[model samples]
Target chain A: MRNWCLGVLAAFAMLVGTIMPAAAQLHVDVTQGNVQPLPIAIPDFVAATAGDETPAVNIAAVVRADLGRSGLFRPLSRKSFIQKITNINVPPQFSNWQVIKAQALVTGEAAMQPDGRLRVDFRLWDVYGGSQMLGLQYFTTPENWRRVAHMISDAIYKRITGEEGYFNTRIVFISESGPPTHRIKRLAVMDEDGANPVFLTNGSYLVLTPRFNPTAQMIAYMSYISGKPRVYLFDLETGHQQMLGNFPNMTFAPRFSPDGNKVIMSLEKHGNSEIYVMDLRTRAVTQLTDNPSINTSPCYSPDGKQITFESDRGGSQQIYVMNADGSNQHRISFFSGRAGTPVWSPRGDLIAFTKIEPGSFRIAVMHPDGSGERVITDGWQDEDPTWAPNGQVLMFTRSYPNGRADEIWSVDVTGRNEQRVNTPGPASDPAWSPLIQ
Target chain B: MMKFSNAIKFAAILSVVALAGCAEKPKAVPAAPPAPPAAAAPAQVKTSSIVPGSAEDLRVNVGDTIHFAFNSSALNSTAKATLQRQAAWLQKYPAVTVQVQGNCDPRGTREYNLALGARRASAAKEYLVSLGVSPARVDTISYGKERPICAESNASCYAKDRRDVTVVTSGGATS
Candidate 1:
């Protein structure tokens, strides 16, 4: 799969110097309590050739959608543009954009190269400062325009917010259908914006909790095959799946290590589930937790020095942290509700978890030491929280109060801009992949 | 006593049929008349009246499922009584192998509920073993909250969903 997509990004060589000595005056402070969307203008990209018209228009539309959905940018209507951009090389007319309250502007062009490849160029401009913030060029196949569009979106987003963009990512989730009692769950993958979905499994068996490795080329999930629940690895490149091990009991709740060389999961024997880690290369299994209670959902910190998991050792389910070698285990969550499914953020600053209250389950986050806990969602049942690669946002599953629908939802780490992500059908247990290479 | 009597009668009928066959010369013997359809019908009905160690027998005659309290795997008196019946049934058919499936309500998280379900299944298996059922004859699996018997969000439905079910896997009546 990697080889096939390699041709799309055959040469990403930088064309011009990217340094801009002039500081950018137009920026969006995402950390503020309440953020007002920055009004920006993104007109249709110029098509250099007759055959490049559709790709140009589509690419610009996708970029607009990506930024608009982030709740940080309000893309102005194309009809509102006073000056039509016919050439990306020329400077934009600042007065025309300023009249429409546009703080920032993006201009780009798509052309078909003589070598049978498509060339795309984009430039982000600070309209108020009248200075160009970013300019880049990409060479790829025509069919790969969506990915190019995402790259452009990320470029603009990073320039304005001063944080890494999560637009260029994928989400691995479980697509669910049928009745609640007899649900059919298949492993599915799609873009971060819920586009170009493809099911990885046939729904012949129940699959749950799919997570991507750091490279996003492999997935680890729990499947009920032959009436036995076990952990399995699915290779995205080869389209092949194999059971993780020949354990004598059920193995589930699997997660890859930060380094992507080992998988940590739970193994049940004689009714007790304990945490275990297995090296992907040597297939050597090591027991991490020896407790008789339930210890599952283990996740490694960004530095891979410690692990955080949920356990019932204290008579109720709660989040616990321990060294990577399973020593010095201690509880970190002390709250009114039971917390489980704790996931360490990639930034290593917070841990996302599912907080089970009296009659509802909400998505919450807390620091490594368990202080400064805050609930970020108000769904009746929101669980299985997964962080974006940048750790600035989280995606989770929310089941309606009527118990009929389950949808994927995302929210910023600041507990704002909550929105529902579109899916083909009922979905759950979403895991966001790292930004694609 | 009833099983022994039936076995004796069946043996006598077999011996008589064998003697009759021996009396006839092998070369000139005609095919024996098919046993009266009526005679076979009554015997079949008598045996089919109660499949002693079948899944339906376990479900209808002896309880095949036991309920558990919310997040509690400790067997109550009623659950214990049902397990006692299941243990007796298993003992009567020593060749039978069974699997106990633990299920949970939708109130808990998926991973935690799975562990709790495992506890529920093993609790039932241990009880059956204590009642003299061989541990080798039993296996256990946890469905977690994935396979809910009832989908409603009411208390009674949740009570029904939190259960341990005993299913005969092998060595039972085919029907």
Candidate 2:
């Protein structure tokens, strides 16, 4: 057991080294609207040994897919490449890449070390400026090649977009199947690109709204265990599950504190739902909202100073904000339609939610002060907006008008490149994790 | 003696007519007889099929489900009448305990719909208790929009989805 735990820890802690300083010769301003995707070229990573060929080629393909999906980088096909990269230690042929209108290029090499670990080195280059923009190396077990690929993608994305990359992340969601009347929903986690999916529970009972803690590998979700619906916590490493609180009534819509020390959720008693907070260490609970109206879906700001939730206290469901101590509560949404499921961005600048229009529901985002509300997607039924760690993108669940299927979709904060994420089956209630360390 | 036998036959014919009338009614009438008394010799057969004080009796004889408006949990006259029958059925079967499940249409956010479903279930439970059912014998759960009986997105289907159903959990006979 001890050896197993140590192995898990080692897999999580990949050693990273910066070999060269990044230059700003080639940059993409992601904050601006209507920006063009920068053309990039990524050839296969050269393998130093015969046995390392598979990992080298697979890593490069994953990195290319990651950057291409971000919508800020358009990866040029290998068929269009003019020069074949044989050595990553040396700079690429800039004139060959320049003829293809490639603004940036990425090259890497993978080798098996004497200690039975994989050593991967990558460098991002500026084609026009003819210089190395960034260079980095990582050491990890050979089996964790996908994570290494994601980390390399993050480095290239950060060097170009001037923002943190979300490639090194995981998404936890409810994998749904069966028919509409008797659907089976199980809690499942996967890579951000929908790889290595593992089901945490069997589909005996229903589960919904699995949320990841910002600072830990723990998840808080609602489940109908033994016919009682309540909030429960699951440890990702140990696979141990426990009910969050022993409240006399139903507890659900749970979210973690920004620091991951407390859990805030709704407690229903005698048909009235109110917000409550519990310290995980002490298991002590405190009431946050005492209104008869629904005060659920509570989320804390990145600073842990304030909270945003959805409530019907003012007749229709709308988004509201309050202090951390439950004082000075006020509604922030005054639009014509109803709004709910408010999640504060990690950057603490915007809150993403679902807007109920006349005939449809759309995923939308607004500033903390209730200004600059923008509906990003126009699906027939789109809800449950979760933020990317950098707050530059949002993922949500979209249901078809036929009411037979539900799928997860992602869109940019600037309302561009709406695409459906691949899952094994019908899925919903997606929660994106922070960047893996 | 002949007049007494004729009176018995007349009463049996009247009850058969009443049962036929109830079958045509839109809602399930709690007071309707389970079978016609004209077939008195086969009374044991009818009782064996649908045992009194059973879960099937509560579902078929007395109404087991009631619906609410789009976003409101306040019970209407139709819903109240159904709960009254449910209370009578529970009182007759004192050993039975039930769980009221609240459901909603897929028109609202999940968390809010869950809270709304809880309200709808509580509304039914409260009415049953007010009509003399013991509070200890009734429990409540909210399914929100997770379980919808109707899959279409039309108003009629939505109305069917927004409902509360009482299910016998323990100590009830099964048929």
Candidate 3:
């Protein structure tokens, strides 16, 4: 530990061109706090300008909502604040926050700038140590108040949790209505908290499995536009839709590469489906698997060198992994039930999937090598699992046996904090978007 | 092309007439067709892009649908027999083009069921081609578990849902 501190101090000295004390006092042991919600205080942000009081209160309210919904932090009520702060420039009154049982405090200020953008400044403080944990400022349009609030929440989250925040992300899913047998499926996008949902395509043609590329502003999904299933790419900014490429008979379950330059999906020809990758720039398609059995739902490892997917070559469905160039194909999931729709975590440690047993379909996670398998949800019929960008949460669809009431639900990776993600109505096939840039 | 059964058509008209009576009905799910309303006289009406000819006759006589086992797209002897009959019916109207729609039970993941449904449709198309039907005349599509013939969550409904049906797309003339 001393050597690590000395090494860090040396690196810091080189960056600052000065010698510095080697002190290692910054670390959060998050492993122990899994079950207990962190106690925090979010006092109403003070308005720098006299007329911007309402926006300041809203900014603090949004941060509280984002953190509260995550189930990680419990924001103490503003009624318990013992000290009234009028500005964020001064250090927090740590003794007052400590008396209220708040281990952390988040304070900020907002003002309307001359150029018409709202300037939001925030500081996260540790009550015990009397230290500023995080501080940042953002300039955004006046209409982008929510975005500025999300940025502040993200910063506070990172400071306390030692992980990236998924608050600024989005979700792409299939919104369903009508009868169970003949439902109308349309593509919809929304914020991580189910706000500002925009239906991308009308129900003119059926769409399925909308996967967003974390590295770019693109969505690869399957559509039945030509009376047959094929993959299509939708540009988020311009809203241009185009067929991925002129491929074989059918293409389904399209997922983007980790770098967003290629798409790995399944192509069926002559009654056989296999995995394939198509380069987005050249439109060049390459066959990854030539097996006679079905291989689909291919997801890339975080490093973009390996792919994990499901295949039926051995008999029933099981998860398999292969190189990016389609070599060394082997099975990763081998259990009593059938596993499909395997998704790798951004941290590259675990893979989440839908596990089917005798009468139930469950959402489960396992190590990359298929050990430490645990079911996160005791779901009656949960399918389509997606990781929350931070790799700490999994969201999937839970439905009754009749396929009537399908709703998206989320659970922490440790199998606790299970809750429903509210949407407009019956929604399915949710894919999480990467953290907003 | 889409085809509506006469039973469904009559039920549609009946529901339209009864709409005034049950204006306050809490219809969360559309009332499903019960027992298909029996084999009424064929509608013989043009709807969507459908034309009345061999497709309607084949649905009534030779049975345009073939059932498969759970999670298995392989054709059994009974399925082969049904495909043989469908192949003969198609040979009667050689100019007609058809699409075999494949479906599955509501037990598996949505995307895999789509691929499985595709396999089932292609299996039916291959069997038809083997029985002397022109390969170019048959196109295939898999609705997966999306368009189930039965909506219940029982074994019998699942059995009915895991099947493929051949629908005539073009070149069928009314006679």
**TM-score of chain B in each prediction:** 0.72, 0.73, 0.69
Relative to the true structure, how large is the alpha-carbon lDDT of every model? 0.89, 0.88, 0.83
Q: Supply candidate 1's per-residue lDDT for A227.
A: 80
- A1-437, model 1: which lDDT tens digit per residue? 43434654473735444434445888888765237899989999999989889989999999999999888899999989999999888888989999999999998899999988889998888888888888889999877788889889988888899888899888999999988889889999998998888899999998888999998889999998768999999998889999998998899999999999999999999999999999999999999899879999999999999999999899889999999999989999987679999999999999999999898899999999999999999988899899999888899999865358689999988888898998888899999999887
Worst 10-residue stretch by lDDT in candidate 2 chain B? B39-48
Question: What is each candidate's DockQ, to 2 decimals?
Answer: 0.48, 0.63, 0.50
Q: What CA RMSD would you report for each candidate?
A: 8.5, 8.2, 9.1
lDDT of 3 by residue, A1-437 (tens): 11211221121100111122322233444333346788889999889878788889998998999888777888999999999988777776789999999988888888998978777777777777777766777767666677678767877777677888888777889998888877898998887888768898898889999999974368899998777789999887778898888875888989998888999999988778899899988989899998888888999999999999999898999999899999999998887889999999999999999999989999999998999998989978988899988898889989887657689999888787788997878999999988877
Q: Which stretches of candidate 3 lie over 4 Å from their true place?
A: A1-33, B1-52
Write model 1 residue lDDT over B1-175, tens digit each, in one string.
4466467678878999999988956686788988765644433334334567887778778898999999889999999999999999998988899999999998888888888999999999999999999999999999999998677788999999999999999998753
Model 2's DockQ score: 0.63
